[model samples]
Target chain A: MPHDSAGHTPIDMPDDPDARIIRALKALLIGRGFFSADDVRRKIEELQSPAPARGAALVAAAWSDPAFRAHLLADGKVAAAERGVPVLEAGLIVVENTPSLHNLITCTLCSCYPRSLLGQPPPWYTSKAYRARSVRDPRGVLAELGWTPPRGIAIRVHDSTADMRYLVLPRRPDGTEGWPEGDLARLVTRDSMIGVAPALSPSAVGRDPSGI
Target chain B: MDRLRFAIGQRVRIRDLPVPGHMRTPRYVRGRTGEVTQYCGSFRNPETLAYGGNGMPTRGLYRVRLRQGDLWSGYRGSGQDTLEIEIYEHWLAEVGKGAPDAP
Candidate 1:
């Protein structure tokens, strides 16, 4: 094992049993014509593309249609069942942000997310800093995510457990009413679902950077 | 290990196991009790060694619901609101029923 300047172990792995096993597996898999490291990287990039539109569509539909919103709140699994999105079964709860009591989700231990609704988690969602600080200091974590809750509004931080996963239903942005589902879907960004940012309005669209 | 089963509306206490590597069992609910509001289908436990330590697979997962009040006593929120979570069979035991005491 390689020691740091202070003679202490840093986060990097050494040529220990676990490292040897990973090296062996990598060699065997690469030799067997399986996915190379580059292939895996490409696959992840493909999955993380602008595919959030589908989930955005669902969120927009819920915002526009009260009946659909009821279905979504009542049984999110069945509401999203047609889309073939897998709902996390562990006493998983979906909390919608109302005019009051905004909710945010963080995986304190690991990134346990709703793959069915959001497809794939963003890079920032899995950071060790996010995992550790979210549970202890949720308000600070939200600030780091670039979200500043309004004064006098209480912030509720929900730490996702291994058995429980959480999804935040951000409030619909203003000036989006009577808009088409496709247009509204385009406004629903990944950051909105995580409660870090609000959904984009028609004017805010195309102003932000292209692609996730 | 036998296939564990519990009906909806039944209360169960979550257990904590010192499994090497990754596990889906959250540290907070290690010894907490919550009611089972749903009967999710079963498959091979993902917490098993075969599924890797981390939560990378969902083929053999079970979905369950837990009320917020049940999870935390004196929880202040809308009484109708409930939180749902997916837990593997290995992380649960029937409370005050036929299941053994959680260690």
Candidate 2:
């Protein structure tokens, strides 16, 4: 396999149009001293790194501290910054999921997401089926994802179509009243942060640290 | 900052223009009326930015909330269920009279 100066196999092996465009753009910028090949490599590695724990930490803090939760709902960027998590791109909006309401996030135009906090979105999140059906049939999509909100709770779908990215602050699970922040963080899964599922109940995941 | 043309709680309709090129407004919302729920601050217009333009004079962005039933016929789910989207000011037109309390 041939590799570029970045020391990684080319993303498009067979000279696809997208590969060609990216290659040309990288060469032009590098040739112009805009950035180095090292920068490109580092960026790719950074994106590939898994960082869902950062988002879960924020959610854990919000669930345990009322003040933090208020700040998160009011200004997600600041809340993330308070926790030392960087939200560099689009503005962040933390939507709360209450007992009577559920929130789901999607990007119909593209695969825009809170990558700075949650790292790369799941492949399923960027699929055409999800992008098309999320806004149209959110409940159906959630059901297919193995989660279905109760009849009394309404579902609200948010489309990140522009400059703002969304994160769902799922409701704290029951039977976790005295759980420490670290343990609470364990219950906050990536799917829960995306609003596809609720936080894991203590009974489901077990209170023992080893169970997680 | 460009003067904001729409306010929160005001009713507005998304314009369905046929201008081609990079756009953030999805086709599913075109020609649909919704309520402004938030003033999301202004940002560089992606349409101009995509084509190497300066994207000067940032545009005001708002989060509009539309009833799922209004957007889709015979929509299932609670009547209160809705969809929220971020839309630039240019794509929105004022609907009726003054702004009311946002539900």
Candidate 3:
């Protein structure tokens, strides 16, 4: 029940312990001048600003330029920076999917995702069932998510158990040859970047020409 | 910053030690064997960091690849299926170097 320096407790504070702790810490940090209230607000804004488009842009560039693809696969943070995407994760790894291999990402311990590139993780990504089953039965989870790799193609699951955040560079769908990078980016959905689904097929993109 | 105990491609086993506090090592992989696929660089020990420790002399973090069949008794996927997890150096011990205390 300790009041902040203002001598007033947050009237709207929830009864939840975690939320209370967070609020208390925020007040202490601000009081100590670790960071101003505006800094926290701006950080929240930055985190919520970029959607999947940031990741899609990188995927499209990799699909279009072989050299850029090499750089992306080698150092994703640098690649993202080159394209104006700021990766705030400790490390960013871009895993590639191929004809014989498919990659799936899940944080078995917690929802450790490439948030800076792809925005906040989807609810399913943070669900307990997903955190458990994705490592135990990735193929089954992928199937439930509406994607199943072809027979003989292996599924490799990445468990974000530590500091590194993963972004799956799903294979570019066929029939996208000679397409502009922007149009190609339009086909890269958030699910594809998470490796739960493939990029939108050329025909599917054609169906939603406006992508509305 | 001492020499990393494990190297890429070296086989190691996750220590099955029961840690009481915050730890990044997952339970399922404990006592399981895997190959170090990549040396993900040194990082502050999260177990200590979680408790507000300085976590100095960072430990190495590695991407270890384990066979799905090896992890789960009834794994349904092909033998080629694998799971890659980031494991801290302290949580892993060299396979066959000295057997881990029996579970």
Candidate 4:
């Protein structure tokens, strides 16, 4: 392992072959004038800046407004564009969680996540275990992920293909009536939106709800 | 035809054949039959796109809904447990095409 010019370890870089290859590719592209270092950095920052906040904002708005929720379920792209969330480029469908039916999203072939709405997928979502198990045994998979829906509620797993993406609109947690959109949004976590867990209950709010 | 061939509520089965190249259909749902819940518009085939093809020729896609019991034996979930997946047209065949009153 080679040290940096300042002779300090870069925690950003762990000894990974993929990182070394990417660095080499970046250097080659820069040398060939195909892209500047600033361009790469800007792109990296753009991807890194995308978080679950966008999805949470949309969910919060929907929870507070029935019209918005109906619009989101009817047409996700238009609803997302209306909210300035930037999901219109791809086909998106928002599956709502009903009293008797639960919705779970997964991409079995590869990690075809809804990057436009929720940013990158959580690491476990891309793992083979999740991809295979989610389709075959969604309830069991949900149990493993620390969420077990009450019995008798049918679990419907959506296996997303490259053409279309699915987003889960988890039922709003209890005891949040009359809550403002912003506060309701705070309770929406990425895992909840992915259907592996439920939106944080009022008791679980004001603390790190992510079990990870 | 790019337009959807399978009407909503029609029954179809995912082909279980071994494809030689790229494919978007997951193996787990292969050969399983399901009802067409929605008509997803046409799109370029991912199978060809993965191989760097132009992907110009599009195929119809549908949201197929199936019961978990149909896909797995001894399903542990409630009897009403169901699943849905977006599958391309070419991979499906109508199950009861000649039956009377078949939609």
| Deviation from native of the Cα of residue A195 in model 4, angstroms | 0.3
Whole-model lDDT per candidate: 0.64, 0.88, 0.88, 0.84
- Every prediction's TM-score for the first chain? 0.72, 0.86, 0.83, 0.86
Cα distance off (Å), candidate 1, residue B4: 10
Off by over 4 Å in 3: A1-17, A20-39, A207-212, B99-103
Task: Locate the minimum summed-lDDT window of 10 residues in model 2 chain A.
Answer: A203-212
As a whole number from 0 to 100, the lDDT of residue B8 in candidate 2 is 80
Candidate 1 docking quality: incorrect, acceptable, medium or high: incorrect
Could you tell me the TM-score of chain A in candidate 2?
0.86
lDDT of 3 by residue, A1-212 (tens): 97567966657747698998999999999999999999999999987877999999999999999999999999888888989988987699999999999999999777898988888999999999998999888889988988778769999999988889888998988777778899999899999999999899887866433333
Task: State the lDDT of candidate 2 residue by residue for A20-107, as single tens digits.
Answer: 9999999999999999999999989988784889889999999989999999999999888988987988899999999899999999
Model 3 / residue B61 / CA error / Å = 0.9
For candidate 1, give the lDDT of residue A184: 75
The residue-level lDDT of candidate 3 at A74 comes to 95
All candidates: DockQ: 0.18, 0.73, 0.76, 0.67
Candidate 1 vs candidate 2, lDDT winner = 2
DockQ-wise, the better of 2 and 4 is 2
Give the alpha carbon lDDT tens digit for every residue of A1-212 in model 4.
86456966656766589888988998999999998999999987877677898999999999999999999999888898899988744698899998998999999888887788788888999999999889888889988878888887889989896578888899987777778888888888998888888888877776432232
lDDT of 4 at A15: 52
What local lDDT score does residue A130 receive in model 3, on the 0 to 100 scale? 93
Candidate 1 per-residue C-alpha lDDT over A1-212 given as tens digits, one digit per residue, 9 for 90 to 100: 86457966568868889999988998889889887978867877855553566567778778878888887767677776655555544433556887666676777666777765676887878988776655445556677667766644555555555444556677887766567777777888877877677677667785333232
